[model samples]
Target: VTYSRSPASPPDGPAHWRPWRFRMSNDVWGTPVVAGDLLYVTSFEVHALDVATGRRQFKTKDVAWTMAVDGGLIHGSDGPTVYALDAAGGHERWRVQADAWVYSLKARRGTVVTGTRGGGVQGWEASNGEKLWEITGAQTDFETPESGPVIHGDTVYIWKDARLRALEARTGMERWSYPVGDAASCGGVPVRVCAAPDGHVYVVAGTRVLAVDIDAGMVRWHFEAPAVFLSAPAFAPGPAVTGGGVYLADYLGTVYALDATTGKDRWRIATESRQSIEPVLVTGGNVHVGSGSAVYTLDAVTGTPMWRFAAGGEVMGSPVVADGRVHFGSADHVLYTLDAAGGQLRWKLATGGEITGSPVARGGVVYACSKDRCVYALDAVKGTATGRAR
Candidate 1:
């Protein structure tokens, strides 16, 4: 669920769910949310499914373009407003009008925050939608496309066109603004930043990956690739997800691992790619990634190729590693599950349409959403279909 995950109620579970599988409506974007016993999937509607049984618990109208759960509440955005809903009942707790179209929602530490298309960034009370504070006194470009704010701890990092700014989580005070660009100017290309465990940031800017120190408020080091600089919003690099240190790929199909604290180059390797190195998911001693038609698993500690599996179609979504298996969708309208340790094919299931979003799991159940206008919940082991959308 790379679109976003609830920062508070973190989802943790097995490698794959194969015994009991199920299906629901799908979409071109969005990820499923697994909180406790309920799995929330968003397509044309927001549905809450029983994690163990794959039963539809509740459904609501289009609520969250992006969603997160915190402090026992579900926070999401509908067009230009933010709504707090009961996670169990799918009922609205409160709604607040934003300054512009609210496209992203993040809730953590008892607060709900959002970023708008107009570059307006603000937060509110998670319980009743009381306005908190907004970050001010910086460049507010109406033309620059905006994105969501992600919280690591007490800081919220937001990226616009070229600048990545961090603000105090509670007071909305500006902490630092780093201008990320190449040799010439800054503020044009779409950028993404991921917080590292060492309180540093791995930023993806156009054709380079940079390591920025949160405390010092500057870049520790940056690795540039021999690729064309991408501007605006067409084929931007994926979000840099870090594990032991930093794992990111550029548009040129080069994946680099840099030391999280020292910014030392651990290893750099080329991938079998035609377009972009979308992103990497690191967990359970393995790194799951895709480029073009093949998915590769590399040793996170030594950067060794464990195995490579070429799918029947183009691997579109990022691979989610759970329950000792790698579950991902392909452009051929099929979801493939591979043995995480050996790269053997366990099973492949056909969906109604192209699988757009990544698969997510919790409690031995995996959830996938596709353009087939449905979401599927499959058993981690048997891959059986347990539920279907009505």
Candidate 2:
């Protein structure tokens, strides 16, 4: 039956939708960082909660678009400024004032490097937030810089003006630059650049997928999609290289497995709808995707369908797997878990608002955040719903 006038309220859904244990009264847009005992999230304030009790450990009033942690240091950004906080107590250690919002945060070998929309990339001392080096004029032609900097070894790789530039991670000096697209394509803004254990850089930019030799900064092989790509391409897990090949999908919902060395197509599978820019994950011999309102599992080797799990709303974030189960959030204020092999619903927990961000599992517990202003800790084993041990 269709809703006549918005109905009395949302359907009750399953009783299992009730949350386990929760920390209340703040919206979370980015994924929660759980380290040792602290769960960190940023909305209008930075919150640190004890994982065992879900109790607030500390709070900082300044907020940011995202936050990250490396060991004891918490890194966060608020537009033109980035803050370094004491992870244990939310104490401000130091802060950096930059030209634009710090979009990418990476900690490498005692240095913190951040990418910004203001056409600048800056490196700072992770211990004290001191500016080590700054590179300017990394301008994008049209699209805002979406992908963050990917560092492999001592080199930093970033995209700007449709080209991929490899720079010295320590000094911000340019080593070499490879045009991902022609000058006509506005220097193909890459969706993501990932590195493999073998030292090759895998890139997905517009309709093309490229494997670059990081040392020489040269394209090893490139594969172009059969369809004209969206200026903003569909999202997939991306450039997942393992064994002998790489896996990625186009905006057209076609997933392709390419020979990692030669860029030859190994297999391709087309899904039901346009796969939006959500991240794709390949693990446990399966390729997991949250496409529109459905999540699908495909065989990693042949691209054959394994199973599909339907959700009540659009799933924008990628799913996480642990202990033979799949966990993800939906637009309809729900967190769901399923048996990885059979696509069977294990449990789903309801939330105060849309569950747009992804879920993280650690230490046998799954943690999720919602736009409605809450963070929930759920039991990963049975979903019988109890938070902490208290």
Candidate 3:
């Protein structure tokens, strides 16, 4: 029952199958978000498609980056305007313009929030995109904002000029701000943090990695390492409650696991070469990640090298572990599938262009988009490609 735009050749399937096609523009700059039978994507235009029919349900051409969606609305930003659209019909709701480019968008309750270049932060109505309030004026100048804003209940968190600000999600009022380091000294927007399942915010700043308590907004622990900076803290769900250890990768091609509670080093692995993708920890003590042209599996607990698999090109997006497989896209214009535990090659499907967006797996389908401007939904367990040409 899977539909696709690529001429379906039943390489290994039933006889009475029909090949399908979903028409799209020649470029998909953002990722695809699948909901039910409808798949949503943004490029120069926003589109909603019937995944099983390869038919366009709705299309909106005004906005560019459809960043995040939740609470039944498609939230996005183009330049400085953050807008929301009716999730079902692609109908325009309302739009709000920020002082700088809004690159990150999120939604919670009735509000939509976005982070902007030059340290601008804003909150809006998720239903109408009305500007509820905003906060600006950080100490140092910021560059293009790319880091996401994380919301923990009513608290919205973002880094502006090297300071991570916790704001009242409703009023855009600052609750507390923590300075990671000198913003100007480390370039702009240096710290990237994620909310651990244990409720602590883990961030990387200069040579120090920090864990901050969510409610009190105080630094609970900090770890120092001489690792090259690039990757952010990654946490896995486990029984360790004092602080769930965080995993990170550095530009120097090393991965480290740090105990969240004591800021102590657990283990580190040097990936023989450089790695740009974030390390992914999967179920059953498996960690899957990629570097340059190589993918690897390591013991999630012991950091012991398990196996390594090489791809055709560089890996940019983080590897997605799902349904017993590790999925990732490469600059070589191919989407690779690997056994999550053994790092063995499953399959690699070639694309017409480079893939930067993360692969999304839902149901039994693996969905991915490439700069060549196409979105594909492949059979996750079968490697049967089903998708459209731009």
In candidate 1, stretches whose alpha carbon ends up further than 4 angstroms from where it belongs are: 1-29, 136-146, 160-162, 181-188, 228-243, 274-278, 385-390
lDDT of 3 at 51: 58
What TM-score does each of the candidates earn?
0.82, 0.86, 0.87
Taken over the whole model, the C-alpha lDDT of each candidate is 0.67, 0.71, 0.70
- Candidate 1: worst-modelled 10 consecutive residues by lDDT: 1-10
Candidate maximizing TM-score: 3
| Residue-level lDDT for 256 in candidate 2 | 76
Between candidates 1 and 3, the lDDT winner: 3
Model 2 lowest lDDT segment of ten: 1-10
RMSD of each: 6.9, 7.5, 4.0
Error of 3 at 350 (Å): 1.1
Candidate 3 per-residue lDDT, tens place, 213-250, comes to: 87778999888777545656788766433323677777
Model 2 misplaced stretches (Cα beyond 4 Å): 1-20, 139-146, 182-191, 228-244, 386-390
Please write out the lDDT profile of model 2 over residues 1-390, one tens digit for every residue. Answer: 111112221133222232245545655777788887778877667788776556688888687665678858887787689788888988899987887777677776766778887667788877888887887666444323245676667788776666788889878888888877643562243446776766677877767777878788888898888753322312223343432357666666677777776788888888756445555677777888877788989987778899998899888577999889999999888899999999999889877788856798876678888876777776676554444321
Error of 1 at 366 (Å): 1.7
lDDT at residue 142 of model 2 (Cα atoms): 31
* Candidates ranked by lDDT: 2, 3, 1
Clashing pairs in 2: 17-350, 26-373, 162-187, 162-188, 235-276, 235-277, 236-280, 237-280, 245-260
Task: Tell me the RMSD of model 1 versus the true structure.
Answer: 6.9
